[model samples]
Target: MQKKALIAMSGGVDSSVAAYLMAQKGYDCAGATLKLYDNPQCSQPGERACCTPSDTEVARNVAARLGMLYYVFPMQEEFRKNVIDKFASTYLNGGTPNPCIDCNRFLKFDALVKKAQELGIDYVVSGHYARVQKDPDTGRYLLKKGLDSTKDQSYVLYSMTQEQLAHILFPLGEYTKAEIRQIAQEQGFINADKPDSQDICFIPDGDYASFIEEYTGNSSAPGEFLDTDGRVLGKHKGHIHYTIGQRRGLGISAPQSLYVCGKSLQTNQVILGKKEDLMSSSCLVNDINLIPWDHLDGPVQCKVKTRYRQPEQPATIEQIEKDLLKVTFHEPQRAVTPGQAAVFYDGDTVLGGGTIVTEAQLK
Candidate 1:
């Protein structure tokens, strides 16, 4: 019997080629493009979007070329509630949010996987640049870094469970970006040269503050800019406009340069301090998810990344309290912000990860 697979086509070169590869391997395949967002509020009628009409067109065309069934699953409501609303609420509460993670957790992995199961699909395939492997010893599925280290997406995917890993396939995991592009070019895909979506798809301009305000229909009020000593430095435009370690757009001049050390919605204040104030030796993580194992009750040496795009740093993982993990970096890490993911890695394999809850409670 042919193995049935549902390929998530984002209409990018990576996903288009992923679908092509799966079909070439003789998997019973269907293509799906998740409509994650409505037309960008600010985009012109004909503008391209990550999962907009144009993107769906590209996916449909590719599916046609490959002679596979294709469909656009309208998941805008799920995306709005799980991703966009979560993003806005996080910012409102003085925390930076990673929407892509929410999208994957709720929409792709949760919702789409359920759909695949109902349709009798054996596997859900995506173009994420990460690999899912099975440990021969434990027989547990592991999420590993892609062959292209620079394009590795294992960090955001650490939330995946062994079951999710078991049913998911990443055809692009073994290929590099250059090779994916070459495949797309040779296949004569229309979006072969399309630029990867760099900005958040819904907020293409990258003006997160404005996007939040416009989307929520409520403006964040101006707040006080306070120095490390708790003295008023200036008035900030809004609390939502600043994030940890932000140095530019402060709209003020000081004797020495200052960075955003913290934000407080309770007091509506933005705290500024010297760059050195940003360094931290540890942080606490919550909402933990462990892969390849059940718990982290004991200490484990692993590489930890406090933020996406930052290289992993050596750290000791300790279970300090219920639902909490303590990570002590060998060197002081700067701007260990709350609300970001702290993914742990052992070699290329993801041990697990969680949301950063607070700075390490160093007494």
Candidate 2:
């Protein structure tokens, strides 16, 4: 019997090539693009969106060209509830949110799994640059980095579970971006030269606060900027307009340059201090998800990354309390912001990760 697979197509070169590769391998395949959002507000008069109408048409055409079945999954409500709303709320709470993680957790992996099950699909395939390998000893599926170092996407995928990893396939794991583009060209894909989406799909301009205000129908109220000593520095535009480690756009004059170190929800104030004030030795993380094992019996030293593009730093992971993990970096890390993911990596394998909660209690 042929193995049935569903390819999550985004109409880009990577996904188009992924779909082609699966079909060529003789897997029974179908293509589907999730209609996540329209972004009627954030987009300008003429702009290409990540998953807009044009992209959908291209995906549909590609599926037809490949002689496979295709459909559009209208998932606006799920994307808004799970991703956009959380992004706005996290900012309001003084923590910077990573919406891409939420998108993968809710829309791509979880929601797609349910959809595939309903259609009697045996496996879910995507273009994410990651690999799934089974540990011969424990027989557990492990998430490993892609062969391409520059295009590894294992950080945002840290929320995947054992079951999810079991039924997922990444055809681009062993290929570089250039190779993927070449494959697309060889297959005569229309989007062979299509550029990758850079900004957030919905917020085309990257003006986060403006989109938050428009989407939520609430304005960010003006707030006070306070120094680390609790003295007034200046009046800030709003708390939502600032994030930890931000140095520019302060609109303040001081003897020395200042940076945003923290925010106080209680007083609605933004904390400003010298660059040194943002450095921290440790941080607490919640919502833990580990891949290789069920739980950590003891401290494991590995490389940890607080942001997606940042290089991993050496750190020690300890499970201090239920649902909480402590990461103590060998050197002081600057701007260990809350609401970001702290993904732990053991060489090319992902050990686990959690949402960074705070650096306050770690002190």
Ten-residue stretch with the least lDDT total in model 1 = 40-49
User: Model 2: which ten-residue window has the lowest total lDDT?
Assistant: 40-49
lDDT of 1 by residue, 1-363 (tens): 999999998878888999999998999999998877664463422233476666778899999999999978888899889999999988887778898888888888888898899999999999999999899999999999999998999988989977788899998999999999999999999988998876677886678999899889998899899998999999999999998999999998899999999987778999999999999999888888999788866899999998888988999999887678989999999998877899999999999998887543221
* Residue pairs with backbone atoms closer than 3 Å in model 1 (clashes): none
- The true-versus-predicted C-alpha distance at residue 244 of model 1, in Å, is 0.2
Residue 147, candidate 2: Cα error in Å is 0.6
lDDT for each residue of candidate 2 in 25-46, tens digit (9 for 90 to 100):
9999999999888667533422
What TM-score would every model get versus the actual structure? 0.96, 0.96
